[model samples]
Target chain A: MSLSSTNSFEKSPVEKSDKGTPDHGECLKVLSLVLDQEATDEEQAYFKQHIENCMPYYEIYNVDKAIKSMIKDRCLNQKTPSDLVESIKSKIYQQAD
Target chain B: MSDNKRQSYSQREKEKTFEQEFLPHIDSMYNFAYRLTFDEDDAKDLVQDTYLKAYRFIESFEKGTNAKAWLFRILKNSFINDFRKKSKQPAKVDYQEVETFYNSEDVDKSITTDLRIETVQDMIGDEISNALNSLDVDFRTVIILCDLEGFKYDEMAKILDIPIGTVRSRLHRARNLLKERLKEYAQKMGYKN
Candidate 1:
């Protein structure tokens, strides 16, 4: 598929939904807040209801969820080298002395 | 106690506080540095420089504030001012280049020929990390700070020295770019269009 084709699908979920669905942008915002665990109880409930009833909202929610899970699983999994801590401690202490 | 001895004692106290307050964030600092530089040696140097600067400016750092955020701010500044300037590697493609290429008409033909979405589907950690690293530094930094380090939007704005609105927009763009890079893999994982 063409790059433009791929990108067309990748447009901001807030911006891409049908024009008649005015609440799509609000849904997208609430979805983001939900993902970040920053949504209020009322907002979360609204989001849950929207996702259940709206196909576009469901699709956006699922895609965003998968992307977030992959990033959390793969990108943030690196263990900081053990010695690095001691090395920094020693180096900083040396400079202090 | 004598004035000279008192001064030394206060210095030691400050040093101890520095160690206690800031040292705990070494792992985080190192991880941030590693993600930014993508090189062990460079990450080490950057963390070391950050600590040194933190120590030097210890007097100015208010006690009991968000030490982690303060340290992160320092680390970020050093990365921009020092590490980027001294990097031995050739200059990276800036956001302008990436934007221009993606927006250009040739993108359609070039993507079909050069895109390797299938290979990325089977890939795991390093593959994903590479995709993130491939993003322009600005975009990559936001992901590292927000997704990886879990910085709040306002915290990120403070650390990156940008407005909160800028932070939101940048984070939005960063996530979009990352999603674009990993879209094939997401599709394989049953992500719907």
Candidate 2:
């Protein structure tokens, strides 16, 4: 699937963080944290704005996100065996006895 | 279930909780077990065992809380305690060794892959799935938890029984490792990346 360009963050102006510019390695960590929603609001704001000016960071962000979506889309498609549910319920009923 | 306090649910309430709160997560639970075991029969057994244990100890689960995370923690623990021992996969590697290796100075050097966004998007499901399954299980678990399952770092920490910092770094390493694997596929496909 094509990446959606609809996020407001992508349209935000490029700006460097006041904490000083993060190196590539630091940027990678920050990117993961931001995407995982584990980063503080300030960190999220800084990375979103900071990525606008950095091509490599932008590419990494998109590629990483796409990979995550792809995994979720593809790897998780296995159907839970239909009989498994009935079996679990029967066992639980047995436990109640 | 946190060890601090356990909520006692009556038998009827226990069955209600299992039906409403727990069963909804069965599909995700099964997917997780399947990913870990890579065998349908083993995954099915694991999920069945997890559900049975969850019911037998239903009193431990707090209502209206994160049943998914609770169930995940149990499944992960069960995998370790039971499945990991007799697993027919390659011999288990020491966690410390893998952690130390990945924590070395080399890991911070930014292992860049030439795989492009279009290339990743172009890849079929099997390519991506195979690359994901190819990682060491520890690395694979982090990605599956964060990326596939969308558990926040703190939730992942509690589920995996590791510090949040370890969760963050392990996930980062895992993503980079996944990209490295994908890059091989790109090269094999004659992409000049």
Candidate 2: docking tier: acceptable
Backbone collision count in every prediction?
0, 0
Cα lDDT for residue B77, model 1? Answer: 88
What CA RMSD would you report for each candidate? 8.4, 7.0
Q: What's the CA error at residue B95 for candidate 2, in Å?
A: 5.3
In candidate 1, residue A47 scores what lDDT? Answer: 77
Model 2 spans with C-alpha error above 4 angstroms: A1-22, B88-111
- Taking the tens digit of each residue's C-alpha lDDT, what string does model 1 give over A20-48? 45355456556666876667787787778
True contacts kept of 1: 0.26
Error of 1 at B162 (Å): 0.9
Q: Score the docking of each candidate (DockQ).
A: 0.23, 0.29
Stretches of candidate 1 exceeding 4 Å from the true structure: A1-22, A77-83, B1-9, B88-123, B184-193
What range of 10 consecutive residues in model 1 chain B has the weakest lDDT sum?
Answer: B1-10
